[model samples]
Target: MTTARRIPVAIVGGFLGSGKTSLLRRVLTGAADTAVIVNEFGEVGLDHQLLRACEERVELLGGGCACCTRRADLVRTLRDLLDDRDRGRAELRRVVIETSGLADPAPIAFTITSDPMVRHHFEVERLIVTVDACNGPAQLAAHPEVAKQALLADELVITKVDLVEPEARDRLAAQLSELNPAATIRTAVHGVLEHEALRASAGRAEPGARPDGRAPPPPARAGAGGHTDDVRTLCMDLDRPIDWLGFAVWLSMLLHARGEEVLRVKGLLELEDGTLVSVNGVQHVMHTPEHLPRAAIADPRPGIVFITRGLDVHRLRDSLETFQRLARAGAGVSGR
Candidate 1:
């Protein structure tokens, strides 16, 4: 028997008062065949109540439902949602998990990816983060979670743009890009972005699923121009394949040494064994590398995008090359 197709889980995460609920409301009002799982219903009673108000606005969900729960019961709640959908009580094509303001999205991501039951039925589609433009700079400087949320995002949405001055908005945008250069960034007024941009921003189309992002390496330039002046971006284009094991070690060391400074790493890598690996990481957490499942892709070209702070690209590239050589030599010696 064929296994049933798994549904995708898209996450909406951000720091407190970052207009998370506003974005969640937009998500509810925008789509159909979507189920929503909201956590920490009582922590900020006002926001939960405000978001719950969306139920009345989403009259066209077509029998899909949104349930609110605390953090601890998320896995169980997900199972319940699946069960309900299976029972014909509702129809769900995708799931959207709106985390509480103070919650760390990585753990939720871990729960979805690590739990055997959850992973079998569900796969993470993408992580969309909302950042409040007016207060983002202060938040990033004061709260580490704010940076984590920005770093892990597939798309970062800047909310309440109208409330902030143009300079502040531009600075915040630069900081976000420096933190997650690979992420698609869009600005919104009251959480509404253009439909096309929003759809693209709510990614998880399978990494490398889009044929358009491939590009020539960018010109090496100035570092991240944030208020803090710590973040930076590096884009690399490769013509040759790489040894997977060596690359893994290089990445492990990079994160192990400066995970806090390395905000995000994302790209397509061609492994020497002829497998194409898609990598995405934030701080110390990494999603398992995805090998293409569609078919044999002939293009073995490699490209990598890094978002980091306090590290230069040239050094990173040199160290990686050295490790690859060392690893190959070690393998040869062992074979003898």
Candidate 2:
């Protein structure tokens, strides 16, 4: 039996009136072999109408959010899309899901990675979230869902920058960086972004590193302006190589215990075997680790950034250290 090709999926998410549709319209312009799935929370869906001009295969899930009431529909839609491709009914090289403004993208990601049939044929490429520059700060502070959306995104696009003053835009960008230090932040005017801005590779520059391969200044700590939630960013830099087995155990236990609190975790680590591995996860769902070339990462030291809610960073660090020590001791016993 021939193995089926897996399709790449990108998720576009943000809060209400955050310009998700505008960004989707920009993304689909002149792009071929791409299928779009739009989820709107109201009974009367309208975003699909705006997107139809650019895409031929537009699937709409109306009256429900993709992360909650309509998740099953999402899975069914994805399966049908795959079936169509196999039957030569649609030319689908990529799939983009434009989630409702009020949707939390974590569940959508969890669904894609957890469903056996869907996981076999589809993989999440990246999550792109839009923030309304004029209202982002207030929205982020008032809405925990909005904060979660920003925290879990791989790429964050601040839209309507033209409406905000330069100082305001810069402040919002800085705040978002603190919320998600690992995410790549870009500004969009009138929902238009450079073609390359949305590409996965554009944000591949290692977090905390500048384009010139130098480490940038550290961002201010999270928890400013009375965020109303416990969300914060915790960064850890390890001087020694990680024991994969121990690190895995620590992470598994952490997520199993407090998956919802642990919003997002991402980092690069040098293993005891001298291999560099990139690790990323959203809530309880973890992506398969990818091996990387040392030259690709500007920093020699291994580091991880955790975006968590109501979790103590000190306790987390200690727990991980204890697990690593135990793992190394066990390895020594086995070798002896």
Off-target runs (Cα >4 Å) in candidate 1 are 30-32, 42-72, 165-167, 195-211, 215-235, 245-263, 272-276, 283-285, 291-301, 306-319, 326-336
lDDT of candidate 1 at residue 95, scale 0 to 100: 82
Best by lDDT: 2
CA shift at 160, candidate 2, in angstroms? 1.2
Distance from true location, Cα of 168 in model 1, Å = 3.6
State TM-scores per candidate: 0.70, 0.83
lDDT of 2 by residue, 156-228 (tens): 8999988989899888887877778777788888678633333222113432242212222342256535653
The collision pairs in model 1 are: 125-204
Across 1-336, the per-residue lDDT of candidate 1 in tens digits comes to 988878888888888788776766666674656777765455423322112211111111112211111133556777877787789877777887777665666566656665678878888767888888888778877776677677668888888888989788778877665566567777788667733332221112323254222542462442322433555567777566777888898899887777666666777777766666778775555767777632544333457777676787778878877988898888889889
Model 1: lDDT equals: 0.65
lDDT of each: 0.65, 0.72
